[model samples]
Target: MIKSLDIVSDLGEGFGSYQIADDDSLLQIVSSANIACGFHAGDPRTMASTVQKCIANNVAIGAHPSFPDRVGFGRRGMDLSALEVETDMLYQIGALNGFAQAFGTKLQHVTPHGKLGNYVVEDSKYANAVAEAIAKFDDSLIIVTLPGELAEAAKKKGLRIAYTIFADRAYNTDGSLVSRNQPGAVLHDIDLITSRVLRMVNEGKVTSITGQDITVKGSSLLLHGDTAGSVQMATKIRDSLIANGIIIKSLNATK
Candidate 1:
């Protein structure tokens, strides 16, 4: 039986006056806030404001770094060398850390965003670069990644880790997320999503797109804030998980 789970979502994904999701609502529901670090979607002002909100709500703050592609929202792939990836991660993490310090808090973890995040799961170069950067910056910071190469790299680098899983996205048979470009890759039905969350948390398993059962030993589950009806879905997931006797808490919560 699952005793607890940490629900996380991407926040601070806005620039100046343009906002992507209703962050205020999502922050109340999620235990962790993966704030954008100005590489993909946030500006300096946005980052500071978001950090303040996280502090206000007592939510754990995380740095969501990505390839420097604001126009593509960091969803597009880039051919960056290991050195480039390391520098990008360091720059973004440091920027957010500064804001966190100003707000009287500190970053609890680092989760790569979009394409950079996906590549870290399989590409050794990218995974090692990210792990090395985090280790060099602050070895105490948790490196959030899937249960694969990225996790291994972080372990080798002597960094703490938190395993992550997606609640609304379909996974391939190999435990990888289905491509967003594919049809039915992103789930919307509240009932379906809640059911999957229960299985993932309780049984430590999730059904893949090909109908294969895959092991998903995740301590944290991600609900994308940019998805339509995301806030409502997050609420439902949280309520149902609590009703089932699973404690909703942040991974960084005091043990």
Candidate 2:
């Protein structure tokens, strides 16, 4: 069972403008902020502001890089080559790092967002490409992926990996995320989610949608910062962990 999680708040493109929801969410919970960069979402202003906010809040800042499709909000998969992904990863991370530099800080990690990440998880070829991208950018920058797949790919390429498990979503036996279109994909029931998460932490496994036990090495548990009632869920998760004698800390510290 994994404990002492490094929780992240993914701020897709909701940074500068209409920041109320995000700002309020950040204030309550979140130890890390995965700020989007132009491709999937976010603009110059939003990126700058988001980095600043994370710095002010002492939250570890990261680049939430994604496919080049803002219209689809990076949820739609793109047919991009390895070179393209490599270049895009460099561009997004560099952009975020530049903005973080404005505040005399540096990005702590890189979490690939939405469709691109999904594609890589399903394709070993693409996973290799993604690993190449991260390795080129900075081998020290932790590659945040769905743990099993990309983590193995990144580790083989000599890059540090964070086994990122979603606190708001369910998993499948294949170790892929259950499609959002499915009935049990997203858990709105806080009690159910809490129980599931606690079970995973205390048991080192998540029962898949098909009832098979999937081995999970959860170094970081992600709480979707954009979901409705997300704040309440995060609060419950944090407090419940403490009450149960589980610690809330960084994955970096754990490793």
Candidate 3:
């Protein structure tokens, strides 16, 4: 049984006046914040502000890099070369790291956002590109990803890996996330979400969409901040974990 774990959320996804979620409230609950870098759904102001909030809440900061697909919110796949992937990852990480340094902290981890995130899991080239970027930028940075190519690449680069499990997403039998376009891909039931988290932490098992029981030993639990009622769901999951004698901490602390 897992005694401790990190709870992370994708935050700072709003651009200008177009806000997505209640980030301030989320900071109070999550142990880590994956702040977006301009490419997907954030700007300079948002990154800085989110980093400041994370510092205040004692939450770890992580870069959430994505393809240059603001219109698609980084969910749609792009046909970029390996060099493009590497450079984009570096650019995004550097931007967030600057803000993190200014805020009296450094980035603790990196998690690819949206389609890029999915691609890296299966595509060796994308995975290696991302790993190369992180290793060049900061080899000490932990890579938050599922168990796949990205994880292997991080290991090869001698970087730390934090296997993450999604609290609100459905998984396929092959351990990939169900497409958002599919029905029931994103879960909204608080009771169900909390229960799944509990089982994942304590039992290292989750029932996939295909009704197959899959093993998942995750060091962190990912919660999406932009989903409806997400704050409440996060709060409930946090409380449930604590009440069950599971410790909630930042990824850095866990490491």
lDDT of 1 by residue, 47-146 (tens): 9999999999989999999999999999999999999999999999999999999878988999999999999999999999999999999999998888
What lDDT does each candidate get? 0.93, 0.78, 0.94
Against the hidden reference, what TM-scores do the models get? 0.98, 0.92, 0.98
Candidate 2 lDDT over 1-255, as tens digits, reads 545777777874663455424555654577777788988778898887777777677778888899988777788877778788888888888888899888898778888888787877777767887788778877888888885557678878888777787788888887789887789888788887787778777778888888899877776778886677888888888788778877776555544
Pairs that clash in candidate 2: none
Model 2: how far residue 158 lies from native, Å: 1.1
Model 3, 105-221: lDDT tens per residue?
Answer: 999999999999999999999999999999999999999999999999988878999999999999999889999999989999999999999999999999999899999889889
Query: Could you tell me how far off, in angstroms, the CA of residue 83 lies in candidate 2 after the best superposition?
Result: 0.8
Q: At residue 80, what lDDT does model 2 achieve? A: 78
Clash pairs, candidate 1, are: none
State which candidate, 1 or 2, has the greater TM-score.
Answer: 1
Clashes of 2: 0
Clash count of each predicted structure: 0, 0, 0
